[model samples]
Target chain A: EDQVTQSPEALRLQEGESSSLNCSYTVSGLRGLFWYRQDPGKGPEFLFTLYSAGEEKEKERLKATLTKKESFLHITAPKPEDSATYLCAVQDSSSSNTGKLIFGQGTTLQVKP
Target chain B: DAGITQSPRHKVTETGTPVTLRCHQTENHRYMYWYRQDPGHGLRLIHYSYGVKDTDKGEVSDGYSVSRSKTEDFLLTLESATSSQTSVYFCATQPGVAKNIQYFGAGTRLSVL
Candidate 1:
């Protein structure tokens, strides 16, 4: 079974603070690791996709890095607008045809200005 | 935010009633998905469609059913609503299996009272 686990369920950070969210996973074979941000009352927004270990992707103040068994979403100098629930999901190679995703519990980030 | 829209942005209904949520996409994507979000659970796949008339269940598909009669629309129905079914539902789309980037709709908030 494919599973994703995210740690530090909730975090409160001051504006411009830098931190990283952790996502650990166990899968038969990894096809992709995804990062998403979701705000209250809204669906998730895609951020980045890392296809292999040692791969990294970034968007503005957010950066995502993937390893064989874990992934990290690093936020650099975060702002109030960056406050949202960060989600981590993985798609195993076995699901290449179906494109199914197994998601984590997510980390709620609050950036205080 | 990707030309996808979910109807009945918010709904409230009594338990035991039947309910259906509609997801419409203008991108003409070949794959569509339905997922639910709740506290302590990031997002769990309910069902997904690979193409018109081709649908399959996901990990948490027990109480949900889905249909895709057209490429641009996917509908998820709850046969019998229960209090535990109250959640924020999201619809997502992907261009194809090789490209796993998924774009999500605004989401629908359902409350089964």
Candidate 2:
């Protein structure tokens, strides 16, 4: 079965601390991987999309890198504004072509100022 | 931000009552999706519409129904709300130009008593 798992269910870091979140997947054929940032009581906001292995995307203090079996979201010197639940989702090649995605449980990060 | 709106930003209902949530997108995207977010379950797809009158089930579609009568509106209905159905629901739209990238709305929080 196709599935996504994210590590470090919750993390608390002092401001300016760096950390990495992991998203491991098991799918028949990987089509794409997506990263989203969600604030409490709000919907998810799209961050980046990785289509193939070795692909990387960056925005501000966040960088996402993808590999054959997993993806990593690296936060460099994160601030309190960067403290949000990070979500990882995967699209499989065998999906119905309507762009279905399987999501992970997400990693909750807290950056204390 | 993408032009997506979810109605009834918050709702409270009793079990066995019927409820409907609305998702409207002004972008005219061909694909619309419904997902529910919970603490440990992350985001799970409930249903999706590819076009007007074309809808399909997702991994967690049971007890739910969806309709897309026009190009801009998609509705998700719970024939009889249950306590288990209480969750934060999100709506997403995928622009045809980049089918893999999805934009989301603010989400609706539902509570079932």
Give the candidate number with the greatest lDDT. Answer: 2
Interface quality of candidate 1 as DockQ: 0.84
lDDT of 1 by residue, A37-74 (tens): 98888888899999899999989999999899999999
TM-score of each: 0.97, 0.97
Pull out the clashing pairs in model 2.
none
Model 1 TM-score is 0.97
TM-score of candidate 1 chain A against the true chain A: 0.98
Looking at the true structure's interface, with contacts defined as alpha carbon pairs within 8 Å between chains A and B, what fraction does model 2 recover? 0.79
Q: Write the per-residue lDDT of candidate 2 for residues A66-101, one digit (tens) a residue.
A: 999999999999999998999999988887378999
Fnat of every candidate, listed in order? 0.81, 0.79
Candidate 2: C-alpha RMSD to true structure equals 1.1
Interface CA RMSD of each prediction in angstroms: 0.9, 1.7
Q: Provide the lowest-lDDT 10-residue window in model 2 chain B.
A: B94-103
